[model samples]
Target chain A: MSAPAILEVDITRKSFAGRDGAAQLVLEDLRFRLAPREIVAVVGPSGCGKTTLLRLIDGLDHDFTGRIVWHATDRPRIGTVFQEPRLLPWRTVRQNLTLVAAGRDALADELLHALGLWPFRDAYPPQISLGMARRAAIARAFAIDPDLVLLDEPFVSLDPTMTERGRDVLLDAWRRRPTAALIVTHDMDDAAALADRVLLLSANPARIVADVAIPPDQRRAGPEAAHVLAQSLRQARAAETRPGGAISGSSGRR
Target chain B: MLPAASTVAGAMLHEAVAGPLLANLGITLARVVAAFTVAMVFGTALGIAMGVWRRLDLALDSWVTVLLNLPALVVIVLMYVWFGLNEWAAIAAVALNKLPSTAVTLREGARALDRGLEEMAESFRMGRWARLRHVVLPQLAPYLFAAARSGLAIIWKIVLVVELLGRSNGVGFQIESYFQLFDVTGILAYTLAFILVVQAIEWVLLQPLERRANRWRR
Candidate 1:
């Protein structure tokens, strides 16, 4: 018997209103699937629809055209850790987690401890440091034990050391629950470090331009593996820049 | 005549002024407390509803706007006629004067909340009650404190007006009596007492709550 598909997005297309009121496509004919516990990293330029894609997948954006199919036997619960910590300034870290954890204070406490936020549990969002706030948000996300996690630039604002710590915490938690995740990021290192498969998107009116699977052996090799993956990404970018092909078509050959 | 009058005023300020001033202060404080409680509860509920529901906001928008702009004197007079100049009527008038201000302030606060946090809450499968308690209420504290402080200040003044206009007791009525009798010392005593009450509210209530609310916002 085969494992079930945890998530599937079929031929998704999203557009926004342009400055002149013209329709600006952000994503075109996007398609993907995730098996149980699969971790996919999405990379693209700043204005590209990377966040849009994640929004579409998370069911936050229903204005787009496409189908997102969740195949788990039970309805998969979705959780997101956004670019900013986005914690309520008035809420203590513990209270923020309790919002979703409901009757699971123990789980929230454990997660907060794991994320190095136990001491700041009673502290409000504005009282904590940016890194601590982000960690709190991460803890809140994981405390729910979601079936699928959507992370949109979750570590974008952190310093190198903080980013590395955050990555470790996220990986540890992901390992524990083993949930599928779709992460949108601009950092190649982040993609290589955390993702099992790296999906590249084109500039605005984004479409998947490349999807490269990293072997388990390669994933264990650290920065050297990231450097190698970066090379593949450069080639993919080169192919994307080639004339006479729509950005979405670039992923076809991959 | 002036020397004897000054001596009489001084003695009057010491005895007759102090006791009534204190009693009236207590009465005014009680009225403010009651009015503020009613405003805070109903205002917050209404504000949250207005903030969260577009249709309800639109429906009630004109009503709130009109009430907010309505003259406090007119409301007080209407309440006196309708409710017969009782304590409840006075309290209700003060609360009504306060409600729209509280609701407007809280509504703005609710509208200013980050959608990202709301979405994060939803994605976690947070129930409605949990979301309100954790997500909504927490974010609402700053605004609530603000509205409470301003509403208290406003209600304190309104309560005095309500007392003076139709009621038999209160600092406002006492002041009116001094005005009619042309007793400057009595007037100054009540004014000083009311000022002290305002200062007490600032120091004892609002300052502490504001400090606590903003403590984590650093």
Candidate 2:
């Protein structure tokens, strides 16, 4: 049986103030519900307001219409990994985690070990490889022992080997402390690998066009096993755009 | 015409050995340090406030501008006139002179802070103190270092004027006495002593502090 809902995101509209002082709509009618420990990946075209949606859900931006309802009775602590590593360049890997989660040394030790960050625990962000830095950022988020985790293109801009390793690192982290997470990515292969459910979104004012669930056994089996499933996610999206021809009309292409 | 380099060096050595040069330097150094610390403390605090809050910026920015443009010598002269040439008045005048520039530099630093790191800090719900300690202060280090370096340079010069105008004893007092006697060598010697001390501070103190702060960077 499915678990009870942990978080509810119901954003009717979101916009930004344009140069001319007009409200430029970024995302419209974005509605989704996340169950406890459900690792969902949001896949959409680049600049489809994916980051905006994540920001709204992460409670970083409040200038949106509608509300995000958390089913959890108590305050739900949040952890997030942005497009950038966002690790404090001035602090060591260990201090980066501890700086945020003070007095939780034992948990920090576990996360550091799980992420294989002990060897460089005292290393600064600039000293480590991008892949290692990315892992540190993930571990930093999990260090807080958060109930909700949001990642925006966590593995983007990495080499193929790094990307694969990053996926396993995230899966390992989630396995240790399974929580409700929303990962925003444009790569369907990554979406297939890291997520239990893939929420397909349409371009421009992103809406949930299709919600495809990865089979239980197929989850986190590496990107190769789910390549076909991810491709199908793309084909289903294309099918949705077939009739309305949302893919057509480049008049507003900026 | 400028004094000969060797003549100035010889005169400086003579002063160092016999004259009140060393004692004067100690006094001047103390004043410079006092002014530097006071200015940095208030300037950094005010700068971060203005940078973080738009209302505070609008309110105090004009005053900072006025202070920034005011003549340092004029401020020192006025302080001596109002406060009666006391040591505290001297330090306060020098501190006030350097305070505005420090605030302005730090304000720019605060405004240009990394939004991504801030969001990361916020999403984790860090307390105000922790956020300032980690997310904010580290990013502002470069600016802080800069204000400090400039403050030292400016404060010492103003302190000299403060000494020259009303102080009983300091490098500036010695320089003034030499100027009156048309003793070019003595004036050059005092100038050389203070320059070397300032340079030593840069090498020994500020340089090490900067290295420590930037150790995390590549």
Candidate 3:
């Protein structure tokens, strides 16, 4: 049986004020629901308003047309890993986590150890490699013991080895104490490996193009197993774009 | 070199440590501290406010520019005329003169703050005080230190002018007194002592603080 619904998003549309004072359409009719401890991955082309959707859902942007509701007994605590590490340059790794989660030193210690960041807990962001910094950012977020976690391409641009290690750290952290997570990524392989549901977004004025659900067992076996599933999703998408294809020009719910 | 040695010798022979020289130096040092503190507090607050709020920044831009251009001497003389030779007035005048430049320097710092870090803080739901202590203030340290270093340089000079114009017992007033009596040795000695004190402060206080604040950068 599925878990209880934890988040509901119903953004009819979203736009930004352009330089010429005209409204630039960024997102449209974007709708999704997240279940408790479920992981959802949002995949889109660059500039297709993936970040905008995340911002709206994260409650950072309020200029959208619809509502985003978090369903919980108490206020849902949120933890986010931005595209950049966003670790405080002046703060040490431990302090960066501790600063946000004051009086939660034990939790922070556990997160550091889990992420292999314990040795560099005293190091500043600049002193660490990009991969380490990214790990630290993840550690800071998880240290908050949040009910909802957001990741915006946290492992992007890392070397292959770093990316694989980062993926493991993220999975391990989530497995220890799972929460409702929404990750925005362009990497279909990573998305397929990590997410229970993959929500594909269309190009600008972004709408929900597809919602593909991977079987639990397929996702459990890791990225190599999920790569075949991801390949089929991509081929299906390509076929939809072809003239008179089986999924021709539908652009709506599957 | 010869003249400096002779002047140093004369000052030692004439003005002992237990005399008016120490009293005057103490008074001047107190004024510098007072004016510097006031200027820094108000300037940094105003700068950060303006930087964060667009409308306030636009409204205050012209005012800051005017204060930045206003002469230190004019400000001191006007304060004396208006407030009538009080110590508060002297300190106020010096602080007023230093305020705008500090504001301008810090405004740039505020503008240059990383929005990414801010978003991170917000997503974590960090409270106002926590954000200020960790995210906001650390980002502004280099700027704050910059304002302080430049503001000190400006405040000390202005304080001397304020004292020279009205105050009875300070380095500036004593220098003027010796100027009239052709006591060149006394003037030289006070200047040298003040310079040494400034150097010591930079070494012991400002430099160390700057290094500590920017240790992460290293």
Count of backbone clashes for each model?
1, 0, 0
Residue pairs in collision within model 1: A26-A206
The candidate maximizing TM-score is: 3
* Worst ten in a row by lDDT for model 1 chain A: A245-254
TM-score of chain A of each: 0.89, 0.94, 0.92
Highest lDDT model number? 2
* Model 1 interface CAPRI class: medium
Candidate 1 runs further than 4 Å off: A19-22, A119-123, A157-162, A240-254, B1-27, B44-70, B191-198
On residues A41-71, what C-alpha lDDT tens digit does candidate 3 reach at each position?
9877767788888888778999989888878
Residue pair clashes in candidate 3? none
For model 1, residues B9-69, the per-residue Cα lDDT tens digits are 5644674454676677788888889998998999998998898788999999999999999
Candidate 2 clashing pairs, residues 3+ apart or interchain = none
* Two-way TM-score contest, 1 vs 2, winner: 2
Mark the 10 consecutive residues where model 1 chain B has the least summed lDDT: B1-10
Task: Give the per-residue lDDT of model 1 (tens digit) for A134-191.
Answer: 7787787777777788898988867777887888888877876788888888777788
- All predictions: root-mean-square deviation over Cα? 4.4, 3.3, 3.2
lDDT for each residue of candidate 2 in A1-254, tens digit (9 for 90 to 100)? 26788888889999888899998887878878899889999988888888998888777889989999998646887888888898889889999898877678788889999999999998989999888999999998888888888999998889888888998999899999998899998888888888889888777667777888888998878667867767776777788778876543221111
Per-candidate local distance difference test: 0.79, 0.88, 0.84
TM-score of chain B, per candidate?
0.88, 0.95, 0.95
**What lDDT is reached at residue B126 by model 2?**
86
